[model samples]
Target: MLIILILPLLKANHPDFMNMATKAVKRAFLVALIPLLLFLSESTTGFIHKLPWFDIFLTSLDMSYKLDIFPTVFLPVALFVTWNILEYSLWYMAQDPNQQKFIKYLLIFLLTMIILVTSGNLITLFLGWEGVGIMSFLLISWYFSRNDAVVAAMQAVLYNRIGDIGFLMAFCWLISYSGSISLDFALATTAKSTTLPLVGFILAAASKSAQFGLHPWLASAMEGPTPVSALLHSSTMVVAGIYLLIRTQPLLGLNDTALTTCLCLGAISTAFAATAALTQNDIKKIVAYSTSSQLGLMMVAIGLNLPHLAMFHICTHAFFKAMLFMCSGIIIHSLNDEQDIRKMGGLQHHLPLTTTCVSIGSLALMGTPFLAGFYSKDAIIEAMNTSYVNFTALLLTLIAVSFTAVYSLRLMYFTSLKYPRHNVIINFDELSTPVFKTITRLCLGSIFAGWLILHFFLPSNDITHTMPPHIKMTALLITLLAFIIAFDLAKFHWTKEPKNKITSKQFSTNFYPIIIHRSVTTLTMNFSWNLTSHILDLLLLKALMPDLLKITQLPPMLMVRLSQSGLIKLYISALLITLFLAMIPTILL
Candidate 1:
């Protein structure tokens, strides 16, 4: 684990660090994949390998590093996909002056994820957890000069901190009640009374996973670079929450309240984010929102007591989601960072390979039959259907499923289909060999990784488990409806221009986004004005100044008057007069 973590950081200090870091990461991932692949090929699974790094006895309990099947399985996958992201970034950040620093940060980012996944105890896991959050802040603010990037970075950090509070609370509770921060102890000692700690875990997971109320950060995170988005959305930041839940599934099972909370929150986040993705025009933001939506689905699976299925989706999602982000990066760069999909069309002529990638990734995301997403996504929906949940939760999950297809197709239409929107004569510029090769490999995964993983870990027929006809057909019907909705929505939004020129102008100008932007700006300005008027003006100037002036001036004025009068005699006369007036009041009383 130490060697693997250090490999990426070896060249982090090099002058030509950007290029060197990419090579280092790719090699490290490939090297890491070898042992994992070998282990997977073995006939026996669920083997526990212990590599004890630290050992301490807290009274009778053992606090030490240990390795198991779960971390072993996830480590190589994270390494492999993270390497792919780095390789993809070689081309994406090729010309960036700060590419070296960006590459260094990304390498550090991967290390943190590795630490989190391979952690032997909750304490170690939190270290990795905090590391990932810090790296996210740094990477998201890569373009620190851009106000949007700065805000996005701050938002990301703040949301994660909210989640961190939960983690911290859970840690404290576990240490106090269980007397150990080790996973084994926590899992072994589970009871219904463990709900408090479980609730903390849920809160942490919900925020980190970008569920519902805490989800705004995911959409706004697009202010970062495309590579940052790809790395973040795919394997590292968002997945951390899901991973924590999966890691603590045993403890989660102890508390019915925690499980139900996960279910409701997941359902709401899934539906809400999917709907938001449909209306968003920015390509990266759409993908970003979809990450949150899919995260919701993962949460739903966990809530439904299908943590393995959630992990399956995470593995498969990493491939296509990363490819899609990279494709978006390609398109955005080619068009001089044009992010709005409405302004893009007929990219098949200029970017044939990239367009194909977008189609494959988007279709996979839609859970189209036989794609990578199909195996896990369909399984998740089926699991949700069979779970004991209320109608509202079920409906929300189903609606989110359909919206996935709707927005996926909508994205493809505005991005790769329709007539050419660009006036310039376009040419087919072949992508650099490294970029093309890296993307093609990821595309292959997007096509077949789920199928292969499912076949090996969960056979194809295992997912179908003797369900009724209606139950089996649920995914199909929802997908079909999604296609229809996407087609109509696209036609309405992109194909047919408004009849009245003024209305057309309004639509073309994207009035809703403008309204939202203005609303936020207006609110912010009003807040500033109120602060200035109330806190600065009313409290400091109007209320404080005259009183301060009277107090300071009165003493000096009295001294000046006494000095000017040369009046020892006058002062005595004034004192006597005051005394006589006081005596007269007492006498009258």
Candidate 2:
């Protein structure tokens, strides 16, 4: 079935039937995914578990017993399979060749996700993870022919690899500390140990999620194509980190040290990224920064040991964020790829559908009442306030939530409400670019409340064990304040207009960006590292090189003395002690 769908993709560029190729791919996708659909059909009203299909993979590999098939494996795979069917539909309708390539990669990645989600063990999960990473690199560099795309892809891959180091470190630590790295044994050993794994797990999560020091790359990732942004901003991209954290959560400690670190990192990242978003000029970059901030908020929930709420926010935020990015893409496409929201205005008249969808998406982003974001995001704030005794974390999170409103509403106001700060030169070609339409519609769909599945499905009174009234009011009030601010911005935008066109004065536009571009800011920020490295490299290392050579010049005479001393048993006791210590772990295990 999968092969049938892939055939069209392989022949999408064929001369005679390019039109038929997309349909063929769609058919192949449906055929390939039927098994997954059938598997997910089983009802699991009580818990997130099911009979294990991974046993087949295990049996095929000639493995023994202990294959536990349950919901964790099935649910993610089900979601992937479901998303692929949707992607196939969207891709079949997307006419652009570049869009086809994007679709092709997306299909392959979804297949890989299926493998990862259903994997019976860590090995299987890692396999899918690397595939996801590789696909992300490829899709992110979708505009590889462009210089900035190449750079953005590079930054993303490099940053992820840094996180991978922590993953690898934890993997090795597991192997050394415990006999096996399997989840079951690791869980047992984690309880026995002083909880070293928890700290390592955190290092792994922080880097992967683009939290704190790992964050700048996520901001730079906006250089990629827009759909790529939507994917990166939502769904599998950033959420994988949180998923890993949640999965390994059993091993992680809830001690004061662990909680404090999580809270501090989450707060700093939440507040810092919000400030960063405040300065961004590009519409997508602002959203990208928001992604960072939102992810930080998710981390805060996770640190508070509120994985359920984090997961809840993850699902809802994914829908709304993807929606905003796709809408931004449409607006850019409508304006001939002019992404500066400042330059756009009065699009409401020209793009009625987009105006409505983008506004609601922004509303959802701001967590307006009755919207999916309202339920999920406010749930996180409520969880935070309820879980943490320290008021600092909750206070900071509320402040961060306010900023989300500010940036989100600001995004809508600048791009959708006015005639554009700069003149738009491109003609709208909605029929030619249906992929953008698909993504936009998907985003708008979230505003209506489909995303409340998590909140609705979980056992009633599980957390409150009651769904507090404050959740509704908090989200409503926060969203209203944000919307009011946005409305005021729109009113101001309505009253003001740029006098001259962008093309009319080239230097006029280039001058402001040149002065404000992050290059100057970066150099200042890295000044200490630069100064320290200069002295270390030029003065200390270079000067020490000759002195070290002079000391080693007398090695001929010293060699005989050293060899004679080694023969002497003066340090025999020390060597025995060192060997004994090293052998202790092997003996213990």
Candidate 3:
């Protein structure tokens, strides 16, 4: 069944075949969703289908390969969200001549994510993990013409590789300790001290999900197409890290060190990202930072030992975040790719439907009452208040929550409400049929997905019932404050022109792009280039080898032509094939 779904994606390279391929992919996902829903409704327990691909037995241990159902609920979310993103991309990428190629990459991405979520063993999971990393590098750098996109793609891959190493270390520890690669075996193994594996898992989740120190890549990733942003940010790419933490809840529950680490990191990330979002003028960057912020909330939920709540929030956040990105995409296209919200205002007059959709998404993002985010976001906050966490975590989380509303409304004011600052004409009716259809569907999800998740999917409602009156009202009160702050900032634009020099400098220089470049990205890139490009490629591979010396001795002109003409593809293909071959023994032996 999955093979059938993947065929169209792999073959859909021509523009003539793209629409058909996209529809096939969407229908496949929709069809897959039904059985998933049935499984949930039937309250299915344990792995429904297990297929062992092979087995490995060393002198000391035996490990089996298999596929399982730990991410059963997550499968539906992945399918539904991927389906919508595919549908939306048909509209979003309609103008691009290379859209067929883009759709192929997107489908391959979904396939990898599906593999990640359903894999029963750590090894297969990591395979999918690395697969997504590769796909993301391709997708984020899709518009390779842009210098920023190229840099952003590299940053994303490097950051995720840092996380990948953590997963590798954990897998090694688990295989040594438990003598198995299965998740159940690892969880069931009673370790004298779980410090190594637990810490490794935390590091993996933090980097992959863009938690704090490893977070600079996510917001920078806005250089990609908006549909890519919608898919990556909303349900697929970012959620992988959260899903990893959720899956290992039992192990995380065992150690205070790991749990406390999650709490602090999540709290700090939420506050930091929300504050960063408040300062961003780029419409997509604001929403990108919002993703990091909301992801922090999910991390906090995991820290508080409520995996279900985190999953619930993941489902709800998926809808509105995707919608928000789509809305931002529309505005960007309508105004000829203008992303600065400062340049956009009074768009309600030009794009009434998009305006309304963006408003609903913003309200939901801010956790307004009865909206999707309201249901989970409010509950998460209430849980944070009542949990056995320290004041610092609680306070930081609450502050982050307030900032969510501030950014949400700030986006609204700048993009939809204020007087038109530019005399640019927009094609009010440019939305394609498929695009409008997907947007409408997403708006519905933004409005009601939260309530549905809370009622039908989550474990219980008793957590909210135990909270005090003030705790119940905390999200609402802070939201009101956020509205006030948004209105003030919108009207005054204090962020644009701070009275004090120090204040102006703080707002201008402290943003992530500047800070990350100065602190981490530039340093890392230089170090990597020194190690790989100069030390390995130039000296060890080329300079020392006699055949390579002969090649280098070729005329500089001929060498350049040879490299540019066709050798590059052969090299890439050879590298990929070699990597795949190297992994084969690990899987099959």
Candidate 4:
């Protein structure tokens, strides 16, 4: 079945029948994936006691290369990937000449993520980790002609490489202490031995997941195609860090420092990103910052020692996040690539379906009641309230949640409710059949996947269902308050200049993490170059070379002057010296 899905991709470059064939292939693949998902879910339930759904082993240097799939994590990821692939085939890239190449890159990206998530050993995990990094660099730079795309791709690679160092450090510690890189072996070690690796793992998660200090790349990643944004943000690349920490939850549980670190990093990132999202005008960037905020919450869940909650949130976030990006894609496409929300208004009058889907996604994002986000997000917040972790983290998380509602509603108000501000008069309606089907399917998931996953897969005991009514109602109440505040704020026309221009610009610029990062890097490079030039180039090479050369050339200069002089005695003396030196070797022999 997988082979059938991939065969059409190989011939996707043939212009004669490529379009229809690829579309049909994508639909067929989606159809085929349904039964497979159902079968996996049923088997997982029936054989819940059985460990590791599937495994592969290959022997090299007496080490086993193993792959294992845990249904709870892999199922939601598979579903999201399937939907993303279908959406990629829609009208978004229908006119691009390199559509086939883009599709291939997306498939390869998905395959690498699957490998990473299902990896049973550290070596396999590293391979998958590097694979995704490389593929992301390629996909994010898909529009190679654009300077922003190229820069975004480079930024992603450099940031992820920093995380890769952590992964490598962790692997080295595992190999040295445990004599094996297998997850099972690493887990069996003493806490003292695992603490350093856990620290490394946290660093890896921070970099890949875009924690507070390491998050500028995610916002810049909007330079890519929207489908890339959807898949990259939703399930595959950004979440890999959180997934790693979740996979190592048992190890994380044994360490206090690591958990505290996760808590601080997550809390800071969530609050920072949510605040940044509120002041953004670009449609895609608003969603991108929201993704960073959600990932931060996932980290918070990990810190609270509730990996199950984090995993549950990952599953739920994937659906609506992807839907949100696709909806944004449709809007931007319809507007001939206009991305500023200030220029977009009253979309509901023209593209009602797209507007409705975007609203659903935003609501899910803000943790509305019974939606996909509410199930997981509310649980995480509840856990935060009940846990004995940092007080500051809890406060930041709650504030970030309220900020989430504010930004989400604010986004909808400017794009859907206000009078049309865009100059384009084109009638933007529902796109093709594939677009409709993809959006509808994701909308359903955004509504129900969270509840389904929570009820079926996640342990109910972990959720603090018996909390006080005030605590239980905190997220809902905060969301409602935020909606009211945001509505009031929305009444003002966006065209009017803000009174606090500098503050507004700072928030819109993501608090200038990108600026700080570039400034630091530039200063460091300039300092190093200056030091090298002064010490090595000027002092050693330039200052000493003339004297050394003059000293070395003195004998040659004297010989040449003597030869050029109109003096037979000098020539005879030089000839006698040469003959004497030449005869010395013969005499010694």
lDDT of 1: 0.81
Model 4: per-residue lDDT, tens digit, 7-99?
A: 666666666344544454456446545544664566443121112333345422222333223433454455455555545554678899877
Residue-wise C-alpha lDDT for candidate 3, range 224-248, written one tens digit per residue: 9998999899878898999888878
Q: So what's the TM-score on candidate 2? A: 0.72
TM-score of 3: 0.84
Instruction: Kindly indicate the candidate among 1 and 2 with the higher lDDT.
Output: 1
How far in Å is the alpha carbon of 118 misplaced in model 3?
Answer: 1.2
Worst 10 residues of 2 by lDDT: 60-69
lDDT of 1 at 110: 88
RMSD of each: 7.3, 12.1, 16.0, 6.2
Instruction: Please report, in order, the local distance difference test score of every candidate based on alpha carbons.
Output: 0.81, 0.64, 0.81, 0.80
Model 2 error, position 278 (Å): 2.6
Q: What is the TM-score of each candidate against the true structure?
A: 0.82, 0.72, 0.84, 0.84
**What is the TM-score of candidate 4?**
0.84
lDDT of 1 by residue, 452-564 (tens): 77754542123446778788879878988889978988878657765775653532323434565578789999999988878887779866898788988899999877656
TM-score-wise, the better of 2 and 4 is 4
